[model samples]
Target: EEPWTLFTDGSSCVDGSGAGLILINPDGVEFTYALRLQFAASNNEAEYEALIVGLRIATQMGVKNIQANVDSKLVANQVLGTYVSKEDNMIKYVEIANGLVSGFKTFSISQVPRSKNKKADALSKIASTSFAHLSKQVLVEVLETKSITGKEVTAARKIRLKARQYEVMEGVLYKRSFLTPWLRCVGPLQAEYVMKEIHEGSCSMHAGPRSLSGRAGESQVPDRRNGLLHEMDRSKSGGNDYRRTSEEICMGQYCMPLWYSKRNNLGQRTMVKSSHGDTPFSLTYGTEAVIPAEIGMPTYRTTAVDVVNNDKELRLNLDLLEERRELAAINEARSKSKMTKYYNSRVRGVAFQPGNFVHRSNDANHAAAGGKLGPKWEGPYEVTDALGNGACKLRSMDETILSRTWNVANLKRCYL
Candidate 1:
């Protein structure tokens, strides 16, 4: 039986850097290369870049079987779909790596302990040195293995189920957790299978959030789907544009408390009656009955009539004109009032096309105006394509990271 060899490493320098990649077959033949990248990148980025380099080499060489390994927990977990990319730079790296994986015919990635991956580590350190340069040749060889298959159940590529889990919502299939090259390329059914395998311990599950040691408390399932249109949540956006029309408003705050209670029907009627009575324009009993002594006649004072009539006329005239037309003049004045293109700017944005590598900020607002980022934005992510108007599909430019789609607002173009 032919033994499989693993090639893995990273490269870096003070000014700029690149990742070093090496692939070895059972016979001890070595395939090596390096990726030259700009300076000031994180060590994790180098790891993912190295993985991409190795995978690229593997695909080109037509190696159908692989078991690439990395020492970085972040790179491994991310590629395995166990971690979420929170930093802006990380998001980009994740996206790029995902893209490369899909482009291959057969591929899978795993993370291993640093102590167990000395060869890849050595190659990475070598690439970071000043003598490091990309090798233009591809190397391959066949070799023997003491035991190609061992009792390393933990290293299996299938999803590993742990104690923690997510409940499948009604009617919703367990879609793949959008976290790999091979599973992503196969489509949704593979996702379902992965879910089953994960629950059964075949693959190592990342168990996001569920594994956190917290006292049993109320957990709010936040609505993650984009609202009514694309509006942000109230806590984040301050206002909701999807407000119900007043005609659809049968009740307000006061009615809500008892709205579903046993006395709700009676309570609502009483509240509605009280509201109607409190209005300024209502029938009032005169000091003396106007009709036959006890008969009350509703009286409208001249002053009240004049005020009501005048207000009604004003509203009628206003309703006849378009609000947009009226606002147009005001908007024009404001537009001209600003001397720059970015005054009182509601948002900052740029258009990105498919296949452009960009870094997505981990900030909730997608690198919104202020705050310190770990390394600011990081990526050489390939934009798979733009999704509608506000979101973009991204694959990690590096294979060591996971691939996922994100909103355009979260991304900043990588100049490099």
Candidate 2:
């Protein structure tokens, strides 16, 4: 029997979370679903939710074979056993997906580009926004919670609050302190947040635990003075410090104040040398930046400018900019080629032909195989096709093709 083909997408926004599923049966029957989630969820979570629902729907219809497509690379990789689901919520979702896959005689899930899955994407967005307007043919379901068991939740809670002496009041933890009646306590999950806000921040003092505890008794004077000290210290430093201060002043003066912007930072990257041994900026602009000192006291390039010839020279430089850029590109490519050769010299390529039995790396998929004591390689899959570039398609001994290609690095020959 031909397998059912499924395309799934998910959307999560401030309004709500939703999932869309498009299932096509072997008989050419189509089933579409738009699920509006009542509970809060991330994009990846919604993706998994949609896939689980789609798989259940297929199983209910007595469909034994399935081919699934998802726009979420993480979900697709996790389902294909190429990526490990480390987060507790994600692990639960993966377990649920695995259970659903086991029920089917054959199943495969592949990652497709978002552009190709526009219909599913639209359905997800629509379900998240106006669920009431959805067609009757498009089934709408609500997932109240993720696939987490009460026992698992209880265990997680126990682990999170393990040996910590604190009392919960209105969803917040409070711990008794000698200095105060009650001190607000943070959980394991909140540690990073507290660190970011109060300690390890751009303006934070970044004090050691002992130092921070010592200063906890001080008045508000400490915080105010710390900020002053930080500012003063930054202003007083020399070398790169002066350059940073100048850049900051320029940004503020120009009203382009994005301190942590990556685009602004990329502008400061040093230019690589071209074939003529000139920096990219020098080759294009025909001159390097004139330092403040050089401007105050004239330098060779600053003093030697003739207005009559400057216009002509500027035009000539503009005309040669494309050639300079092309030369830089060629130089960069040659450097990359040399690096690739050095890397390939150390690499021992593993080659497998069609019909060859191989075992896949078990690093991520060992959870179901007794974990620590499990075999290093999980499969005795037969290579169905060589996908070139060290990738190959595989099928299980049961004649079920895998959803994605496996890299040669992750596979080894398995002699029967």
Residue 305 Cα positional deviation in candidate 2, in Å, after optimal superposition: 53
Please report the candidate that would top lDDT against the real structure: 2
Candidate number of the best TM-score: 2
lDDT of 1 by residue, 1-416 (tens): 45345657665557455576668876778865555565666677788778877777777877766777777788878877899999888888888888777765556677677677776666556556643444655355777864546655554533356312222333221222212101011122432232223222222232322221011011211111211111123453324333434343221111011111112112222111221221111122111111110011111222134564776765654564354344544555665666354553856657789867788775543434555635556565777777687777777755543455678777788876
Q: Residues 311-396, candidate 2: write the lDDT tens digits.
A: 89878878888887787678888878888999999988789999899988887445247567767888789999998989999999
My TM-score estimates for the predictions, one after another, are 0.29, 0.33
Worst lDDT 10-window in candidate 1: 252-261
Worst 10 residues of 2 by lDDT: 251-260
Off by over 4 Å in 1: 1-4, 11-16, 104-106, 132-416
**Model 1, backbone clash pairs (residues 3+ apart or across chains), number:** 20
Model 2 misplaced stretches (Cα beyond 4 Å): 132-416
